[model samples]
Every structure is written in structure tokens, then in C-alpha cells.
Target: MAKKVRFYAGVEIDKDGIRHTWSADAWQQFMDSCKKESQAFEIRGRKIAGQCESCYSPAVFYMHLTKSRELSDWPEAGDASGSVSNLATRRDQTGIISILEYTYLLPVSGTPYIALLRSSSGPMPSAIADWVSLKSDMPAAGKSFELQPVLRNDARQKLNESLGVKSLEVRFEGKPDPNSTSSIERAAAEAASTIDESDYANVKVDMSISMGRATVVSNSTEAMRKQALSILTNNNIAKHPIKDMLSKGWVTKLKAKTLQANPESDKPIIEPVDFIKEHLTEDADFGSMKDDEMTPEIILSGMLEAIGKFRKRSNEY
Candidate 1:
């Protein structure tokens, strides 16, 4: 009995800009390609937690999702098409940021990252201290991308257990609250004189991702209420849902990497490892402090470090 994994793969867009569907569609295609490679690649099926399984080579995965209609179905385009030019983009503005987020995962083993790329002067890659992540360039030309939700292995097992993970599909269309403060409502209001108290709002919407497809879900508020989680106990979802998303496709490797010798950023999420490493030279063993009370300040200061060192730390009884 595998648990069903459900997560949102969406890009932010303006509700009125007309590009929402286009953005969502393009991301869907990019994720689809990565999924294909995972299922087809060799090493990805070889090792799981360091054992032979279906495919286990160092694996790499990516996702690209948007809220645009034109770009939504580009995944269906024949081989003749590859790039999505401005002609393929549209725009929309919703009260909400209308953000669309995609997710990608890579094996700890050195592989390539495809969902995102850079100009050599772009933002520093999202690599944690004690462990650095490196990715390869995009496989397609004329298309630019950025990697996000870069997670390691805190979520792989749960993903494998959940088949058709996030395979559920549903769409959403919302009515403006008479007292709502979303920017889109003001725009919609300015366009009309005192909208009818019962006027229904609408947009031509479509949404799809690696494991699911859908249009707008009616009565979105109700839907959300129904979907909210009740018990955090026994819940295995990661703190960052994006990273878990990165793990779905073929995974090839999960090797440990060297840390930066000298860095400027005060934050590397590795303060704990650094603290312990420094102490190890003097206090090689826990001595009598294995049961010592750890303080909140000490614990939170090294949370990022704790997160980094956590790889399949859970033991099965």
C-alpha cells in the first residue's frame, strides 16, 4: 500500500494578462521530457539507497510550469518545434501573485541540471555548505531555464512509495469576494460600475504537469478546505515541497561532495556541521555529553546544517 503524493506544480501569472496558460503549459513540457529520460536512462534504475533496483544511475530531474494557454500544450508539438518565442507567451494578473512553481531533483552524484541555466553572472547556484550541488547545461538550444526547489534525498523514499504521485488533476476558478483586496479585483472593478452582487467571473483556463492535468476547479475555497491536512503526526511531506518534486523522475546518483574551503555568505545551512567538526579536533568523542540538553539557540543556529546531514537517517524497526 503506497501513499499517494500530491503537490502543486504551478507558475505564477496574472489572471487577466492572458499569459497564465502559456507559462503553465511550457513548464509541463519541460517536466515531461525529464520524466521520459528518467524512465529511459540506465544508471537511474540501478541503485536505491545504495542497492540495485529498477534504475539507479546518478539521476537528474527538472520541471517547468507556467500559467499560459499557448505554452500549455507545446509538449504535444511535433519534433519540428523546440523553442517558445515571445509569440508563444501571454499574460494575466490575479489578486494572488499567480505564481507557478516547478520542481527538480538530481542525484548526489555529479550530473546536469536542466530546468535552469545562467549567464555565468547569474545568481549563485543554490548549493548548501558541507555539500555543493552542480548541474549540467540545458539539453535544448534557444531555450533558457532556471532550476528551483533544488532538493537532495530528504524525500526520495516517499516519492518512490507514492505512484501516480501528484497524479491527481483539478482546476480552479475563483469569484472575487465583495470584500476581497486582491489587485485583480480592483482592476476588474474599475472596468465595471459596481459589479453585480452576484456577477460571476470567468477565464479560459487549463493546467497540467508531469503527473496530472486539469482545468479550473469550481468553488475553490471549498476545495481548499477539503484538501487541508489535519494531522501533522505521521506526515512525511518535506518542509520544502519543491525539493520533493525534484525527486520523482529517474535518479542516478546520491554521492557526498566536498564543501567550500572559503565562502562569503554567512548562511550555508552548515553551522552545526562546522561547529561539530571544530569540536571534533578537541573533543573527538561525545565523552559524557551524549545526553546533554541542547538549547533552542544552538539547535536553530544549525538547522540548515541538520537538514543537510539528514539523509535517510530514519531507521526501520
Candidate 2:
């Protein structure tokens, strides 16, 4: 089995913000930055980072926004990780208008696939749709939700000025899907960088495409073929690019998974700190309950308990 490799890249966005542009050199820069940051100290999901796997240039920087954009309202965030969550609650309706976006970059086949996801708080309901709306009745926003980070690809320039190379061949790892790269390239053309419902519904992604070939190297060709097909088909990029790749005997079959499913119970879930308190007590899975159904007293009590935990952590508040 080939070694499992993942890259976390962060690019500094201008005041205008980073657009969805995932390109060859752009992704390379991101991985380089991440490696540099992790050289001495380690953080979330840290592991043994291999030798400088940076084949591209040291131009791009990958940024994981641990904060929110609405909270980035001011012009200069300037090294502040951003208290987006708190600012969001105070915002007009980050509760409704705001969303939680989680992005992942999977490095395979020497290529990168940026997974972008957008999740929102439950929306308001219509008269007759109350019961039905209780569940996830909202439209199923396709694979890429709106307002994904926009990346402006400067692959050629990055390669020449930064990476210092000629045309370096690139591929989306694990799958020889051309559209994976195409998707990233396509995302770069969102035109406007502003956030509006109309455009936000569709993310602008370019560099986040799958860049690589379907590769599974093993002692057994059978195992290699199966593993490659599993990953390629799972990501669904195979159908678009390398249609002829499947024509090969190595690829036996392709199958798409069924649609998956979420909820909006928002029943005052307990935080990790709370769990530690009550001396690691057990209570109702209130988060599974109704948000509107929660009482003021319950809310107050929970806050009090959380404060107590904070006090304990600080040795007094």
C-alpha cells in the first residue's frame, strides 16, 4: 500500500480575501507553509511529517481559517485568528445567514483535493411546512455549497518566479480525474468576491480540484487496481476525466454511494468543559432536543455551570 499523505496549506488572503483558486503552484506553496509551521512544534492532528515533499515551489501558503468571515468584518484582521464565532452570534443573523464551513485538503497521487463544505443553522418555516420543516427539508445544495473560499491561481507565475522551474507535470492524486483540476480552475471564475445568497449558494473553487493519477502500487496488481478504483469512484471524479482509464483491465467496476443525511435540534448541547464538570456527569442529550423548547432557567443554569468550570480551570474567576 502506498503511504497515506495529507497536506495542510494556508495562503494569506489580501484584504479582498482569498478566492477559490486551487492550482499546481498554489497548492505547493500551501503545503510548504504548513510544513514550516510544524517544523518545531506540533498542533492539531499533528504527525510525523516526512521530508520536504514540496515538489512545487515555496510560493503558496495554505491557511486554515479557524475563525469565521462575518467576524472578519473589519478591514485588518492582522494576525488575529479571529473570534468569528462570538462575532457571528452578534451579527445580524450569523445564526441564519451565517454558516459553518469546514474544508479539507487530501493529498493523493501527488495532487490535492480540497473538500469544501458549508452547513447552516435551520432555516425559518412556512405555515404548512412546520412539521415537514422540522426535518432537513431544505434544498439539497449539491456537492459544493455556496461561498467556498476563492483561490486565484497563479500557477505559471508561481512556478517560474517561485518554484523556479519549467512546466512541471502535475496530477490529482489517487484519481486521474481531469475535472478535479478543472473544478478548481472553474471555481476561480466566480467574478465577484462578495458574499451574497445568490452567489454564495455556489462556491468558487479552482485550486481545490483533485490533482493526480489513480495510483495504487502493491505487490499484487489485483489489490492495486481495487484500491485505486475504490478511491477514484468514491470521489466521483473518475467519471469526468480519464474515461479511458476505466477502459483498462485494471479497473473492474465503479459504484456510487447512496445519499447521506443532519438535523437542527440545537438543544443546548454540552461543551467539553461541561463534560469535565459535574465531575464528568451524565445528563440529557439536550442538544438532541428542540431549541425553541429550551427554558430560560435551563439556559441560565447551563451558563452558570460552565462558568463554574471556567473558574475551576483558572483556580478562581
Candidate 3:
């Protein structure tokens, strides 16, 4: 049998700062109208306030199902108006009970209604929870409601069975001083000066990139992962290579392997030469370097190159 889905109805408010309320009679009428149309209750950017000169912007109110639960007899705004009216009346008489299931006011603007609902619940599905937490915002506008926890563990397990990864750490040096305005000024001043490669030798940019093991069970689909990373990058969560590194498809592939491998039995995958080649500046002369020839300076230079490419590509996009 196909899995059942349940949906709940809520009010959506448009405009940045306006409030609307439904009178008992108006609410009943609205419910009746929804039932007549066989549609969930929605206000299409209509002005609710009387005597207000400024028109409220268009907004949409709609119903959607919760991620984990499946319940029956969810009142449909247009198809089951009577059922919804009856439920609302009962809640009013009984002083608010759970018979109506979930109901909340959706603010007109500034906050996303779906995000507000998600916030009330526990952790979101693993795929998005981290990215959502990091961005501390709803997914970008058009994509907001599309994020659904549709990938079940069985599917993930199947994917896990096909892929493997090796856990590795990439360390880079020579980060700039965030607090030093003078350093920035100096760089600006030196923009026209002759290049001095040795001046950067003592500069320490201490950073570590954790190439986390991927697992089928906890992993999100590649598309979802990429979306999450894009959101992070667009929001400027971290500088360059950190953001760029995580966005790589290989990283996702590696993570899947890492997660599936037995910690005690599987050996970690290592490919220093491949890693360097992918991330390093193509213009740089590596001089027939072998995997064993990989140096800290070379790795750091590659990382910096990757960062530059990421910045350039992002600007182009």
C-alpha cells in the first residue's frame, strides 16, 4: 500500500507588517467558501483592514502536511468546509483542544510560515537540519516549501551499498588576520608593489578541513546536499575553500563511502596527487611531482587556488 499523507490548514498573511483576524461569522463564511471551491483556505493578497490607504501585498495561504505524521480526516478548506467549521466551533467552545490538530498564525512578512512551523518541531530531517541551522533561515524563496523528507532509510541503504569513501583531513596554512585592518591596508598598498614570495613564508594560515565519512543512513541525496551547500555559500557562512571544498561532488562521494565502511575493517582512502591536481592552480609548475612529493606548501597553494576559482565562478553565476 502507498503511504498515506495528511495535511493541515493555516492562515497566510502577506505584506511586511499587517495583522488580520477572522470573526466567528467571517471565519465560518470563509470555511464555507473553501468547501464550496474544494480548496484549502487561502487569502490571495487581499487587504483585510478597513480604511487603510496602503494596499497589502499579495500573499498566499495554503495547507501542507507535516513531515513525519500521517493522520486522516484532515479538513479541506473547499471540500470539507463543514467539517472544519464544526471542528473550529468545538475548539472555541472547549477552549482550544487538539481536535483541530495543528494550527498557527502565519505572519505576513519577515518570517517564513513553514520555517516557523518547522521551528516548533524537533530537529528537521538530517539532510536539511544542519544547513538550516547554519543559515538560520528558510530555504531560498521559490525553493522553501519544496524541501521534503522523502528519502527513507531503505533508499539510503541501497545507495550506501554502491558507494565507499575514505576519511582524510586536509590542512592549509596562511589565513589572514581578521582583526588586523593594517594587514588589509598593507595588502592594498602592496597591490602595485613587486611580488615577494618569501614575505608569505612566515605567514601562518592555520586551518583544517574535515573530510567526514559519508554514510547511507544519514546522508541526504546529492541534490539536497548540493542545495544545502549552495545556501551556505550564498550566505557567506565561511571563506572560499572551506565553502568550495564541501561543494565538490567528490566530497559527497567520499562521505558516502566513509559512512558505509566498517570503522574497524575498512582502510581509509588517500589520493594526495589527485586531490592536489583537482584543487591546485593549473598555471603553477609542479615539476613532475609525485604523490609522495606532496608538500604542505603545495597543498596550501592548491587550496588557495581553489578558493580563487570558487570566488570567480560564484561571481560569474
Candidate 4:
């Protein structure tokens, strides 16, 4: 089966509390710097932990990670397997490694979007976001930034199709950091301060929308629906924890059109390269092809196509 490639928007926050979309030049420089640092770490002959490596295409990079682990095994059976297994367990030192490729594409004069090929063994979207924040050389960019997912093509549609929402719920614990530069976190902090509590172990916010109505919808109800959809879809600046909960199939008493059957969910998964080639309008050479071989050129081309689609849709919107 082909791996799934997810998309994200590349956002950078400046020192003066301004958010800016990274230009192609800025992204190129950042990746080059990360590649250099990753190379240096590799040369030391120590575990890379997790670092980005340059790919054949400058837009793509391999996130290399090494983890030391212990391998355990049951002792060999002598007379009876049950008796021998209960005697002792053997342990050995081992390590795990992964190389996940990701791509960043920014038009010379437009919005920026990134593509990441997902794998169970690879880093997650949030982890990749953190990697960019921690590894980049740009000042103040790390404080409040993320590769925000464009969920318009997915979750937003579901929300629109929903019969008016009964309620949208989000549960949280503790208080948000007051000094955080993130607008979402700042808003949360302000709300928490109004309660005059230093911390909250468990706080559930359930927002009623249409009072369990379905057919009839009001303007206020529509507005609330839009905001709820935004948070659920990750269209907003910060991702809400409720989004994670929903992904895990958790739901309460709330009822909406979002819970309805989704036809697109049954579609077959396609590899990024295959999808790009099938959708391509022109002949492009990828050199020699090997079984399951993914070259940097192929990854870059596929990601560029994905980003182009995103940009087109964005412009139309």
C-alpha cells in the first residue's frame, strides 16, 4: 500500500509578534541550515536523536531519528516450556531508527504549504511542527508557529453537511501560560483569569448551538457552527485538544451532521508519487525506477503538485 501524504501551512511568527508566511527563499535557507546541523551530528558518530537530512531535491528532507532500546526474550526451554519461561527473561541492548521524508513548497510570491508522508514509524504532524520551531535559525520564529493543516477540503465539509449542532464540547486541565505568544493560548489564559483560579484540574466547556434543533438554524447558530468547525478542522492557528479526542472516536451526547457516514472515507489510499503521476498533464522523467524506490525528485514533484492544488483552491476561495 502507498503511504499517505498530509499537508500543512508553513507559518512563521516574527520577533515583534507578527505572523508571516515563509517565502521559498526563507524555507530554503532554513532547511539548508538544518541539513548542515544534521550532518554535523551524524559525523560525531553519536546517535542523531532526531535531525533533518538534505535530500536530492532541496525542498525535501529526511528526518533521521535513532533511539536506543532494550530487546527482551524469554529463556530457552529446557524440560518444560512453561517452567523454563517462568525462570527468567533475557534482555539485550538494541536500537530503532527511521528516515521519514518531508517536503516544503513555497511559491515565490504566494502562500506556503508543506507535505509530509505519514508512517506509523515516523514523526507525527505536531512533532514535525516542533522540529521546525526548534531547529530553524530564524529568531522569534519558534515562539509561536506551526504547520497548520488546511482542513477545508475535509472536516469543514462535514460540518457544513451537519444538521444544526446540539453542542460542541472541549475539556481542558490547568491554566494556560500567560506569557505565551500564541493567540489561542492567550485567549485561554484570559478566560481562566476571569475565574480567578490559578489552575483547573478539569474544565469542560460545552457550547450549545441550536438547542437540539435540526432543520431550522439561526444566524447565531450558524456562526457558532463555523467556529466549532474551524477548531475541529485545524483551520485555526492553534489545534484544540478536542480534535485529538474526536480522532480517537470519542464523543459525548452531542449530535450533529458530522457524525454521519462519510463516503470519501472508503476511498483507497494512493501513494504520493502515483497520485502525482496519474494527475500529471505532462511527461516527466524520474530516471530509472526501482520497486518501491522513492527518490527525492519524485517526492518533490508530488509535493509540488499537492501544494499547487492547495494554492489553486485557496485562491478560488
Best by lDDT: 4
Candidate 1 residue 42 Cα shift, in angstroms, is: 33
Candidate 4 residue 227 C-alpha distance from true site, Å: 10
Model 4 error, position 81 (Å): 18
Q: For candidate 2, what is the TM-score?
A: 0.18
Which RMSD values do the candidates have, in order? 23.9, 24.4, 25.6, 14.2
Over 4 Å off, model 2: 1-29, 36-63, 71-100, 111-317
Put the candidates in TM-score order, highest first.
4, 3, 2, 1
Question: In model 2, how many backbone clashes occur?
Answer: 33
Judging by TM-score against the true structure, name the best candidate.
Answer: 4
Worst 10 residues of 2 by lDDT: 273-282
**Per-residue lDDT for 1-317 in model 3, tens only?**
11111111122122442323223343333323332222121112211111101112212232121222212322223223443444443545546443222211122122121211221121122222222222322223212212221122343233324333223222222222222222322232244133243343223222222334433322343433333222221111112223222111111111212333345755433222222222111122222453334333332333333334433432221
Query: What is the TM-score of each predicted model, taking all chains together?
Result: 0.17, 0.18, 0.18, 0.41
1-317 in candidate 4: lDDT tens per residue?
Answer: 12234555567767776767666566666655655554312211222245556556645454444322212311243443554432233222112232332333333234455555432223333444545665654434435455544454444344535443434443223444343333333455567666544224343333333444343445644554544433322211221223321111111222233233336863222211111111111122223453545565665565555555555556322
Task: Give the Cα lDDT of each candidate.
Answer: 0.22, 0.24, 0.25, 0.40
Q: Compared to the true structure, candidate 1 yields what TM-score?
A: 0.17
Candidate 1 regions with alpha-carbon error over 4 angstroms? 1-136, 141-304, 308-317
**How do these models rank on lDDT, best leading?**
4, 3, 2, 1
